[model samples]
Target: MENPPPKLQVKVTADASGSEKTVHSSGLSVRSLLKFSVSATLGGKDLTPEELGELLSNGDGLIRFKGEWVRVDARKVRDLMDRWTQAARMMSSLGIPLVQGLRMLVNGPSGQLVQIPEPDEDCVMEPGQNLRQTLDILAGKVPVSIPELPSRLDALMRPYQKEGFSFLYRITEQGFGACLADDMGLGKTLQAIAWLDTLRRKGRLEGLPALIVAPASLLSNWKEEAQRFAPELILRIMHPSSPDPWQPEKNLRRKDCHAVITTYGMAARTSALADLHFPAIILDEAQAIKNAGSARSRAIRSLHGERRIALSGTPVENNLNELWSLMEFLNPGLLGSRKSFESFTRSLERGYAPLRRLVRPFILRRMKTDPALVPDLPDKTEIPAYCSLTPEQAALYQTQIDMLHAVLDEPDPAARLMLILPILARLKQICNHPAQFQGTDDYAPERSGKFRRLQELCVSIAARQEKTILFTQFRSIIPHLHDLLSGVFGRSGLTLHGGTPIPERQNIVTAFQKESGPPFCILSLKAAGTGLTLTQASHVIHVDRWWNPAVENQATDRAYRIGQHRNVLVHRLICRGTIEDRIDAMLKDKRRMADDLFSGGPEQWLMNMSAEELNNLFFGSPC
Candidate 1:
């Protein structure tokens, strides 16, 4: 008869405070927080390590325990011992990450029911009581109860918004990071605030302050929103421009302070925030860290926080690579290292089912167009207004195109590559207006077809007394657009760009949002694209196309999001028979796959093209 096979039983025990300790030292392994051990049994008899060693030394196929003969394959027993030794060493050196531990519990080590079968061969792994409870929570086998809404919160949350808060609360309470990726105008900020306040009320914050990081432009917005919605929470802004005039580190540590807000740029530049750890950290417009290699991304990741929450409507604006960056920040090691993840994504089959399965539980996304979830959201109609170039604009555009062709013929490939982006920038300025390209103060609408089209649209919009918000990527053109729109609408409108003072942005927004306020508000796309509400405007006009769907969508959502009672008509002014027209067509063709992999605007893909391809794309006929 064959010798009885050796069976290994592995057990896991989780420390109650492991998550807290792990947050302080990101480099430490999960094994430091959890305990693991293995035991061997042969033919219903237990064999001690010494007895097994003796059997191995004797080169025997049988061992005795409790005066019973237990036959076993010595080689198999030795192999099991070797496997356990290696697992113990790894567990001691690089403990499993919290996310990785949770995943391993749900899906075995290799994502199967059996945990690493090749190594274990005939092993049984059992989760201890605490580990099993965590598994139950992760599997949604038991409901996570949320505390009642804090009475101090001034605003009543909509049903969907309340649900959003619950989702954030559940994941965060369990020490898992969350991504609240609701549609742009769906009040991600409000949901986040509600959750933060609830944490305070539930005593979950443990007397440690939470941290909020956002763009420089949105710092004031966060302060105002928190003050309006959760006034009971003592909030502080951590920037030199703050009126409090106190050192940020000292002010942030005040016992009365519940939370502190800072800009991404400041977080990267100042060492004051480097060593501080929070009970929680919230990243507004979290896509700011989409490039994992960026200094901002690295700095944000280095800050200590128990639970990380990211808020963004366009989380994966570009590709899966960006999604990896966001996930890495929220839950490190959940997707393995960057190189391994890149390899995994490359090997993914159609639909990327494995990666999707691994990440779906942590990210929550809702669309504004879902009537069942948001019945009050108004319709958004996008209309592309194609316009021809004026004679002067056409001459400048052609001249630049000829110069690009000449440059592309250079003997050095690197020299040819260096000139493409600047030429593209010049081409875009020419398409916007000849005066804008020529750097002149001429604001005549007849000088450029796009400006003429804008005048026509604004005239019609003004006749109906409907408000409009015009967006452009260029800050220099804001003054010109303001001057022209003032003439068309016969009223002094507002302008907010990068230069707009942090304190004045809210005032400018309030001015535009009033019933009898400005007829039009000209904004720089990058500065005011997000974290502002302009529902008062019924029309949104793009003075120049970004050739990036996510960015333009964000800009338009300023007027199209939740509180807007009127239908939003988005006007995208495209220069016909130019790079803008061709790129627009290419984006429309790629629209079907937008959710999975929409790349950045022309600035990115254009650089990778051959010189010949660039020539054709720049001067290509309208598709």
Candidate 2:
């Protein structure tokens, strides 16, 4: 048998003016009408049939070939026709055949399929030739295959499987602004790191120039956690000794680091460093930029970046305006002017739009209770300890309260304000002992029912299989509590306070959390309340009360935050009949006031309550 005839290949060219040439297989037949019309479309009305034949014969030179003003590559057209015919044959073999002549199919791979137009149907199939190529060109194309992401991303994101993670992923992917509003110790850092790691895996991260603007105190902690969680990532701490701020690009390039952790102070003063463009910039403890017009805020705003993320547990710390500042940084013009933002916030409190749209896409917040992955936390048990003051301490407390009430009644507002610090100091001293602040060296027995009750609770916590943190407003009381617990339980207790030095604080807390030996830690309310993670202790004792609920909550968070497997028990010890009860009542009202004011809601009665009303709580006696 004879071999099948070789398929034909042709090259078509359009000249600078307008032209074409056609080459065909020697055995193929050409119709006279097809040849005449093809030449007419190419040369316009000027060329005759004989001239067109001559032009086709001289295929080596550039000729004017036309099908509108579009330039079609002949090689591309021929290749497309071959692919179309192959695809059609494959489809037919699969029991699906394309109908010819402008037919459409809804279930086709490209969603809809249309047949190629014929030459005589007023559609010009120029020098390139063929209905298959025309059809292939008309079909919309599919994108190239997307490579699979790294398998490690699943392991990395395993820690953040909460609904909040979806919100975070969307924010980073869509460049939407977001605030992670989770309470302290709810794993905000983990969520952020996971997001960054995803970006790295997806090849979206570039230059490896990410800046984590955090508090000076948290700089090292961030570095350690980043290293622990993302071992593959390289980190450089940007400090005064690191390198010249003017040359961040050069220094970062030299080290080939993926991230840099720095404090707000360093980021603000280092103007030269702000010039380098980073692909990803994250601000940890973003509340540091609460003042929109501050130097730190301006410096961060000046820093160039393709993506920006802000992380803060307290995004609306003292004002709603602070939230606007953060939104403005993430997406300018989204929130409009400060004045407009304030107006929008008013309506937003009433559930209005545009304002909600401006904020909803940018902020992803979750509470500790929101994470379904984590088991239910231990219920916070507030064991109110009723303690009676020693006779001397009781006398001193009465004397102080009386004087404070007198001062509060003074005509001058400044005089009344001046009395606050001293009154608070005296009250705190009385809770522990008169000697704690006054240095009187007078010994006082713990006679208050609240004090006796706390001692019993401490004994119970010490006997249990768990650990406990006892918080007191008076640092002087830490040693006393430690001594009391030591006398009762013996070497099973430790004390932590402000003077313990920054480096040793973490060490002490770690030891307490590990529960290798010690069963209790006595902590000053101010010092151990924030920043430190003490997830080992299941029980927290508030030996004294604070005026700010957030402050007390921060203290509770030390033990209750991430990693605790048991339910956290919180004890708020308040004296039954003293200034402590009065103050606690006042604080509840103050917290409501602060929340309403900061949330851009209408002011509460607490904000307008007179100093006389406050004085009445302390001195006028409950009816």
Candidate 3:
């Protein structure tokens, strides 16, 4: 048998529909020919380049060359091309990164049967390389042995946490950054400590030490956990107040420490701390860096590190751009330029799966609601208690606005600010309760909206026999809440505030945890939001909206943390049609600009609003 007229010519045409290219010669496209050529080469022994030319030169019959005859299997080529196309399409659409992309192409439906049995004949590809090994591990073809915790680890990990540790190790092994975004109270701290410990034991962190930057309040928490769990590792706490002050840039080389813990405030403010290099840098409550332009985010991003990981329960608490911030910090250039990242994200409201897939290899998140993680965990529900302001409260709100207007006329800007700050405080107070703003013990439910909502909420909590934690920013309003909730609960509850004595705080926490204890507990948000574990209360009522979701979530976690046997219901009491509502909408929108707007925190939020803006925010809609 000689050969068909023309051997095999593949013509490429522009595809308007974006489907695979169409073929012209024998109705076979270049893509098809490429796939076929790969199969012909891989099906048997390799063919030398000169031999390949002779086979293609035949221009027909059964691809006979050398002394061998290889049949071009049409059906096999189609089937194989379809698989390759399927995986390739997914990779292309998601724009999966290099290492992950190759792994997917080789394992995902395409090369499942064979680890790319042989390189494609058309392209220059290295066969039998490290990439194949990585693919093997990713696809589970090569078993990933979950290593035991270091002998020095005094702490134990949950089954899921151990899995998390393995995930981080595998990704970093490929020279990539990762974000550990497990839900709040899910032991992200422990998983991070485990990663550091593993690296320490493996002697992989020789030239540089690991850095942990977190909120000032949480610096102690990290120190405590590292001491309790990674007892084998040395620790350094960077502090300005210490007699032997620590400065990372100058002192880092001389320090003999496995990990350095510092606050985002300290890190951002101190040049030395921000300039020090770390083998690994982990940011706890990573939302602090959600604003790419903020001093802390800028400072943390400036610090050099071999591996970067972010720990946050609410990674995108407000919006998608915040996710970009975290991603930018983790894998800077991986997501492409910020402008393009933002442009593409705008179209991803309903369909974010593609973006998720792209970053899948770099992010590991497990919510407590996962049945495998917490089989017996109770349901946690979030409810918004929208309320209307009482007519009397509305009247008082107007009076405060008037005072704010009067203060705007102060000749000195500083004096105007002094008056404006107190006016905003008064406005929030009037919203909480008219009596609070008046500096009197007026306890009239008819004068407040939040009070009425709390009253309504109590009836339901009473019927369910569940405990509640009522958090307010104003301590002055707590007595009113305690008084009001006591009647509904039919028993007095506990109250903790900033001024509560240190010794008495534990007693208050212990009492509230008991099943037979009070049905509700009240606290000022700043005081009890961080340290306590009040899991006994299944219901957490936000008497007012805290500016940051992270702060509010921290408060809610008092009950949502581990050890709660019953479902938790979080009720956010918000007054409708006011500044609160406007701010609520801003948080909901979560656009990139909104992140910058909110990044300054509450003081900036209050002070930065122009008089006109503040006026519109308050008077734009009826209370």
Which candidate comes out best when scored by lDDT?
1
Which runs in model 1 stand beyond 4 Å of their true positions?
Answer: 1-95, 102-132, 151-155, 204-206, 407-417, 593-598, 608-612
- Better structure of 1 and 2 per TM-score: 1
lDDT (10s digit) by residue, model 3, range 1-623: 97533222211111111232331111211121111123224333455545545555554447654455555434444444455445445434332334323323322212222323322332223223333454345433666555677655434667787788877776555456678888777778888889888888877566567888875545555666788888777667786533454566566554367887777778788776555567888898887888876777877778877777888877775556677788778866545556766766675667766576556767788887688896767888887788888888888877877766677656555565677767767767877887887788978786788888889889988998988898898887888888898888888999999787544666787788888988889999887776467888889998877777767877888788767888889888777876677777777676553555664455655566676766676567632
The lDDT per prediction is 0.76, 0.58, 0.67
lDDT of 1 by residue, 290-400 (tens): 998999898988887877899999898877778878987887767766776777677665657667666776888999889998897888888989899999988999899
What lDDT score is found at residue 345 in candidate 3? 69
Better of 1 and 3 by TM-score: 1
Candidate 2, residues 333-396: lDDT per residue as tens digits?
4555677567646655444454443355467665666656455555556555556666766787
- Candidate no. 2 TM-score: 0.65
Clash count for each candidate, listed in order shown: 3, 22, 2
Worst 10 residues of 3 by lDDT: 9-18
By summed lDDT, which 10 consecutive residues of candidate 1 come out lowest?
A: 108-117
